[model samples]
Target: MTDITDAAKRLLLGKPMSSERLGHTLLPKRLALPIFASDALSSVAYAPDEILLTLALAGVAGTIWTPWVGLAVVLVLVVVVASYRQNVHAYPSGGGDYEVVTENLGKNAGLAVASALLVDYVLTVAVSISSASQYVASVFPALRGSEVIVAISVVVFLTFMNLRGVKESGKAFAIPVYMFMGAIGLMAMFGFFQYLTGSLGEAESAGFVLTTSEAYDQGLVGLGGALLFARAFASGCAALTGVEAISNGVPSFKRPKSRNAATTLLMLGTISASMLTVILLLAMETGVKYAENPAEQLRTVSGGAIPDDYVQHPVISQLAEVIFSGAPWLFMLVSAVTGLILMLAANTAFNGFPILGSILARDGYLPRQMHTRGDRLAFSNGIMTLATGAIVLIWVFDAQVTKLIQLYIVGVFISFTLSQLGMVRHWTGKLRKASDPRERSSMRRSRVINVIGFLLTGTVLIVVLITKFTHGAWITLLIMALLFLLMRSIRKHYDSVIEELALGDDLAAARALPSRVHAIVLVSRIHKPTMRAVSYARATRPSVLEAVTVGVDENEIATLQAEWQKMDVPVPLRVLNSPFREITRPVLSYVRSVRRQSPRDLVVVYVPEYVVGHWWEQLLHNQSAIRLKSRLLFTPGVVVSSVPWQLSSSQGHGVETTYFPQSGQPPAMEDRKR
Candidate 1:
């Protein structure tokens, strides 16, 4: 049975490769773009909506200002892209924002950036999946209530695809990503043409009059109007959420990694900015409007209320419906592509989160497992963790994109603002040392660009906090705080472990030979396992060796002694009486007594353990051995060894037990008794 299980595991995981093969999984620029830039590119789908939705709060008057707001957002996006291109070129080691801030702004600033990016990555998954669910529900009305489940399912599916390998998954993602770009681009072009020809019409919901809530009904007359516009601009800044992903993934690119990554960033910025501008322009031309609660905000000509069940499609959905009025298939195609792109947006988190986790893990800010790549050369554990967290968020929030969007862009902008500030410092430091006139000029120009980026993003961050903090950004901040604490705790633990393992002043003296070596074989019964354990212990040639057993019953104790004598065992057996049937206590007491007798000696306790054929067999045996080993581990100057007895049920069937070693060390099975 053990053989069969081992074989099954081998078949499932495949053969292990040398660590050197990890480089084979590295991605080229083409693959890296889709792998890491999907989020930023996909943001064009909903960033326009967020902008328009925020403006919709002011009624038709506010909607007219969307183009100006979009242009401002586009400018920020362009500046941010230019700033990050410099970053990718300057710090292409994949340290990204964390590295930049750490190098220039000090460690605490770097940690803050790390914490923000970590939280942002989580929100990226949650928001993208939730938005995808909304798109799915828009296309198929029957899936309305099941959005959470559908969103979670998509996250899980993307997690597996990423776990397979970055290169493989990138190939799969390229087509849909490009198709999404093409479809949206085509829609924008057609909408632009229609507007030129004076043929554009209002969306299906555009006929309904909007009843602005009391908070935003006032015209642009006072400070409140300016604040409202700031809020709208803040929401529009969601377009910049995924811009830093390329910098974080620079190392994943092939030859000239930095240049390729910079190029990819340029492409991502251009495509995303262009697409977003066109989408917003077309939405306004087509008179598309989206309301958080349509039934409440919308009224008919006769003042009749729209039904609660009325499905108000997303801005993109409504625009698609108008653009493809005659060709139903085109609308469905666009809808399908939009949903697919949103889901693929989760792939950006899939790639970035694990890589960032690995970097943090290497810095001792995360569990060590996060630093280790899997069979597919991906951070499998980190990927699964991201997927699980996303699924939980999706379920908890009921996969409502509008609700999740409020918690989105804030964390990302926090990281972006800090990162750009760090870059400004970075270029400033470089300029001081740069002797070459041309290089100094270039560095100064880069510094100016980053300074502008820092100012713009920092202002947006403040706006987001003011506008969104009370709404749901507080929850995001709470999550970031929790994650920051978690990372600090992990770092502390690793530091403590390192300190404990460090060589000390007494190292030479501690390494000196023990005055004596005392060995004992723990036996539960007079059986082959016990006999083999005794034999193995005697082979160690300790100063003293003996077999010890805890006698819980008088009859069994006498029978064991009789059988031991009758069998003429090579080692003498010593039995301890357990009045309370406490196996570990009795064994520990006897070992402590031996240690007290010879304080300078080392006590080696050999535990006779059974190798189980199945998981259930573990419960049937070795309970005392496990308890004994646990207690012995904490004892000073003591070495606990397990002498396993492989049962007939555990052997034979060509099992490969060599791959996964026990406890991250080489398997000690070779020292065990057959």
Candidate 2:
């Protein structure tokens, strides 16, 4: 069974690499771009849709502002990337926003930033995969209503790919991500060329006008219109979702990690900004109309209401349809790669979240299991956790990109604001300690850049909260607060444990000898195993030894008493009755009572257990003895030991005849067969 399982694992994930070979997995810049930058670049698929969807609440006039909103988003993206480049250089420890905030702002602030970024990473996976499923469903209309299942399956696939090792997954994803980029670039360039030649055409939906909600039917003539545009700007900021992944993953880069990370950050910002700009312009020029509910919000040019079956495709789909007009394959190719890239975008979060989780776990803020690397050198616990959280979000939102998107950007902006604030303080502190003129001037310039980042992200945070709080952003804030408190509690527990373990001048107390030894063998039935336990306890030469049993059934206790007397054992037999028929509680109470009477005396308990060659036979015996031994260990001044008697079924299995089960024994089988 073990050989088959191992062979399957090797076939699925390749040969398991050793810890010494971990450095062989460090990524080059080309692979790192797809692994780290896909999320930010792929947001072009949905960021424009969000901009158009939110703007559609007002009227067709509202869609005209898509370019300006895209520009604002681009500017914020630039500042964030520049500020994080400074972070990767200064703190190249790969702590990312959490490290920066923790170092400059102290532990509590750092915990807050960690909590926010952790939440952000999970949402990045959810939003990206959900949007990708939308694109896929657009290409295949038969899958329209089952997007949730498709999104979840893609998430599981990504999790398996990531668990294979970071560089392995990076190489696997590089081509599709680059193909996506080239496809978008080619589509946009061809689109513009045709526009210059006066042959560019409108979207299929361009003829059908979008009717605004009653509140905005007048079209940008009131105070409500201004608030709607602000909301649109806030939603479009989704393009910056994965911008911090490069900073968080500096350690994964090859030799010059910091320099490579900075370069990657610059490239990510540039490509994302350009793609977002081009997509927004194409949507505006082609008059692509996307509404939250197209059946009700859309009508014919002759003023008739559209049918309820009308489906509103996203901005990119609409643009691809027009740009690749005659060439069906080009449109299909663009659609296929677009869907794949959107799904693969979650890989950036997969790469970043686990590394950050390891850092947090090492700092005692999360479970220690997360700190350990798997055979593939990935944080296996963190990967599983991210997958679980993203799947839950996908399930809750029914894989609707528009609804899940409402919960996006809040956590990223939180990390962004805190990270920039930390950078400003970092540079300021450096300038104060530096005496060199050149270094001082350099610090001054970096400080100005971080300050701008701080202001920009801070204002966007307020706008996001005010516009999206009631919609879904508050759920993110609540999750962040809960995570912050949970991490604090974990740290408090680890600190208390450390304090308790600090050996002081109490060595004399630990070395004190006990007054006497009392040996008690826990007997379940008068069998060979019980006789062996009784014989072993008597030979120990203790001050006093006796056989003890819990009376679970009256008739069974009577039979055991008769058999013990027939054996003529030297030790006395004591039977404790349980009116409620419990084993562990009665034994625990009796052991504690002995310690309460004589605090200095040591109580030793010997439990008789069965060792069977076959797995199922072992479960048939030693049930009560195991529980009693466990309960006795927790009693003060007590030592619990097990004595094993090999059953006849164990003779031919090359058994070790040990008292305890082997550590490699399958725990699930014990639980199931027992």
With a 3 Å backbone cut-off (N, CA, C), the pairs that clash in candidate 1 are none
Model 2 lDDT, residue 581, Cα: 88
Each candidate's lDDT (Cα)?
0.84, 0.87
Regions of model 1 farther than 4 Å from truth? 1-18, 307-309, 505-507, 652-674
Instruction: Give the TM-score of each candidate.
Output: 0.94, 0.91
lDDT of 1: 0.84
Residue 521 error for model 2, in Å?
Answer: 2.2
Q: Taking the tens digit of each residue's C-alpha lDDT, what string does model 2 give over 232-318?
A: 999899999888889899999997999999998898999999999998898888888888988777889899987667777778888
Model 1, poorest ten-residue lDDT window? 658-667
